[model samples]
Target: MKAKLGMSPIAWWNDDLVELSDDVSLEECLRQSRSAGFTGMEMGRRFPSDPEVMLPILKEADVTLCGGWFSGTLVNEELAANKDRIEPMIELFRAVGAPCIVYGEVGRSIQGDRSAPLAQKARLDDDEMKAYARKLTEFGEWCAERGMPLSYHHHMAAVVETEDELDAFMNHSGAGIPLLLDVGHLVFGGGDAMRAIDKYHARINHVHVKDLRLDVINGLDRTKQSFLDAVALGAFTVPGDGSLDFEPLVKRLAEHGYEGWFVVEAEQDPKANPPLKMAEVGYKELMRIMTAAGYTVETQGFPRG
Candidate 1:
């Protein structure tokens, strides 16, 4: 395994730098991210959206572009329209030399009706998933020509959320594609997060490390809201703040020879708690989790300005 640390310069709930409050400025985010010991970040929609615009700022901050998750209905949407969205994303990833772009599960939901089970509402459209998988294969091939990979995020909403769903989806898709195994997002479907990692060990290339609250998960299950909708409902946070046992999580990853960024993805009220303060807490938690798993790491804390 290569020696590298990964974290999301997650702007979703960053409490510092109001410029990143919505259209997160790269310059501002890089400063904060670098300060927090973040080696990289998941590019959001507002993150310059153009490599030409962000490349210089990234170099100045000495932060690598970890990659990003793109939101769109791949299985359900028309390929022509979907391509319009994917093409630019591919271009951006190419420019940054990112390994993959995290893509989501495809589904639609009713407004205010959050009582039905999500498993009932969200699912992988086999026929559609196959087509989209081929599209991704083509895209991956295109990226491969340039030495990149497509890490399709098997999100709770996407076709590959559950272990069973992932098994089936992988049977047909993901053969040549890499997958972003997000622990927090993966747990929503009640999937054994570690098992999923082991199953996709070969194809697993990137990660979005996060912790989840069982109470929050149960609450969202009661509402039956989609995964993205639940994000707005505050379902995720840094590992130690939640109930996940990251000890074995990291252990399992190590067993599989997993190497890459362990992107810290905590979408909480950063404004309520100062961003710098939250980062302090996050760094300690990551260290604790890593240590508990018996993995030794440099005792580095985010450099404070």
Candidate 2:
């Protein structure tokens, strides 16, 4: 199961905090991503909604549109309304030939709220958990009907942040819904990333390979700081620059036959970290780890069901 490597545009320009890298152009982002050795990238706020407008730019840089983040409010909104909002993004992905759409359940999420503490993030009760999972399953099925698989992102400050929360969601959610295992978030949220892969490997169809700085994470007061606050403080970084050990996770993914995009996604200040340099570092480190794990890093071809 060969995997393709991709980078997220959040490294160049953060979606939540537009002020970070607001001056960087979409062309420069794509160009620097390609130059850093990533063949593809996830969509960003700077990207055009129209595929015809975006595809030409991507083609010029010789990069593929791997996927894009879709904010889902399934827990609060009606399924029909959620579907209606997502249909256009789904169409855009289909037009650009993206393999999947990354779904982040942002209903009542405080990840973006600088004043809201991380520890006080909203969580669902047992019954609410089951209902949310059911809605997620239905949405996943709807996406599948349109040739796009839904990869659920267990994001920070979301309802499904912790390991037990992730477990409940995965167990209750139907098999049609796939998990997008993000190593950095799992570790940052005080969960074992490798253990998660071991338990949920079969359901994981997409991957986000950001690394965490444990020193910064250990010092953070979850009761006072939000997820966005942590990002501003440099709690996350590319693979080699952080405290995470990627070899074991990479080897496990290869051994389990996990195939898809392993995107390097570190939400940080571009001025401080330098997007192009950090991207190259991430690309090289991941390649080294994957090679050591006896997996060939394929630079072409998207994963298919």
Candidate 3:
């Protein structure tokens, strides 16, 4: 049960805010990730879709393609329609040997609406929750049939953001549907990350080890600022540089026999926090926590030269 370390390109180039690092090339992102000691990296918007083109670049950097975010609208759209949107990405992930597809429900989400208040984000009632869970389960099974697992990402400003909502989804969803436990989003959404790991340990197939700047978070006016606004204000950072403690949470995951990609994702302005430096900070902190927890940090695909 060796755990592998990976990183998100968001720290370097934000997919939501394309202007963050519009000039940074895809080659540079992969290079910086590998140089920062990440053996794997999740795909970004700039990444080539053709496997023949992307695989070679990945091989040159010696980094594995972990996966990328997939915005799902199952809460409002039909499963068949959503399948059409997800199937192509599934094919790409399967071709590249990725482990799972990170699914974030964005139907009626205000995360990207900078002018929209966070408190006005969408939410589902009990009946709507059950319906959404059923649709998610069906989609998860569809992915499993295609050789990829669907990892549900609970995000801020989305319908399923709070701990109670997360619990309801898990309780109602089929056993096949797995969770993508994202620590920073959980905290930002007013949920306990450690408690989530402990409670949903058995169903968590993917992990996003993002840390939050609590001082900034505490000072946020939810009625005025949106999730995107928070990101612009430097709300997220590498695990060690932020306020959240990862040691106990890491240990808890290890104790629960969780072995998967622990991706470091901090969506920040690259000018304020250099991507390479922040990548190093995240890699070092994750390695330290994993090592202290008695989990082997696998570096199999990393380039030596």
The superposed Cα distance between candidate 1 and the true structure at residue 41, in angstroms, equals 1.4
Clash count of each predicted structure: 4, 0, 0
Question: Candidate 2: where is the Cα deviation over 4 Å?
Answer: 301-305
- Please report the candidate that would top TM-score against the real structure: 3
**Candidates' RMSD to native:** 4.7, 2.0, 1.7
lDDT, model 2, position 252: 94
Superposed Cα deviation of residue 231, candidate 3 (Å): 0.5
Per-residue lDDT of candidate 3, residues 148-177 (tens digit): 898999999999899999999999998678
Ranking by TM-score: 3, 2, 1
Residue-level lDDT of model 1, residues 68-130, one tens digit each, is: 766656556665665677777788888776767776544453212344446555554677556
TM-score of structure candidate 1: 0.80
Indicate the residue-level lDDT of 231 in model 1. Answer: 52
- TM-scores for every candidate against the unseen true structure: 0.80, 0.97, 0.97
Predicted structure 1: lDDT: 0.64
* Alpha-carbon local distance difference test for all models: 0.64, 0.89, 0.89
Which portions of model 3 miss their true places by more than 4 Å?
A: 302-305
Q: Model 2 over residues 90-197: C-alpha lDDT tens digits?
A: 899999889899999889999889899999999899999999999999999999999888899998899999999999998899888999999999988889999999
